[model samples]
Target: MEKKTDVMSIRVNEKIKEKISKEADSKNMTVNTLVNQIITNHVEEGTVFQDLDFTSVRKQLLKKLFNSMPKEEVTKMAGTMCKEFFKDTTMYLYGKYDLESTVRTLESWFNSSNIPFKEIKSEDSIKMVIRHRLGSNWAMYFETMIKAVLEELEVKTDSYVKTIDSFSFRAYY
Candidate 1:
């Protein structure tokens, strides 16, 4: 138990004082402590600095840049990322230009990592093939998986998505 000595009193609406006292009682806190905390918070918020410091602003910009790269870099990064992401799984890609090059790079990396892959022809207008050892419903799986990977790489390729044929898994040898 502590003894109270010097006390300061301030006039307030009777109803407000009663409400404050009730809240303090509910929280098992002294009314003076609760009022002090409220006043401190109010003062601090009222006097909050509005300026954004250069270091903090610069850090935010760098964070945004790392999170998102230029479009060309993202395309190249997507190829690198696909290889890393599907290292243990089978994957296949078919196209003529950039997509073909990207997939070839990934395929080489996969081969070097001992992840087996096989390319099979598809009867579609788009150059397409099935991969090896992808399990079931692999077409849908691969499409979604690849899209997600590209998104992470910050590469947008929805317009060219129709160029991809059926993506699936075959034998795993």
Candidate 2:
């Protein structure tokens, strides 16, 4: 079904308008479509970063930090730091903490962090693969963080795979 939309007019600087028009033409889309996409993204996902007070870190710095930490320390920090934060953020964003909200929140964070991820859904479970170049310690950190969130939500993990540059898991809902 098509979504309903409303029409409104707003003014922009002439140069900004020209840039946006050029970008829209280059992308083979109308100005209206590009503007709608930008607004939708801000409303649906960008607010999370704004409201959560997220900070940007260089990948090399994060890589060094993660690599220096012991595996056990990485696991402990990931669990302790992410569990309640994830739960609270999910609740605040979606009005409840469930698998769908959790997954959506994760996707938003991955997107904002410039991490590539793939999600596959089936009748009974959802599988996610996060490909990050931050190394095995980072993978361990993500695995622990995700596992903590799943445990808090009472979800069961069917399988988990971790490597130097990627982490994948299947969770039964």
Model 1: colliding residue pairs: none
lDDT of 2 by residue, 1-173 (tens): 99888898999999999999999999999999999988887888787688888888999999999999999999888899777787788887888888999998888888888899999999999999999989999999888888889997899996799889899999887
Index of the highest-TM-score prediction? 2
Q: TM-scores, in order shown? A: 0.25, 0.82
The Cα error of candidate 2 at residue 33, in Å, is 5.0
Backbone clashes in candidate 2 total 0
**Which RMSD values do the candidates have, in order?**
23.0, 2.8
Minimal lDDT window, size 10, model 2: 81-90
Q: Which portions of model 1 show Cα errors greater than 4 Å?
A: 1-7, 47-173
State in Å the error of residue 104, model 2.
0.9
Superposed Cα deviation of residue 41, candidate 2 (Å): 1.9
Q: For candidate 2, what is the TM-score?
A: 0.82
Residue-pair clashes per candidate, as listed? 0, 0
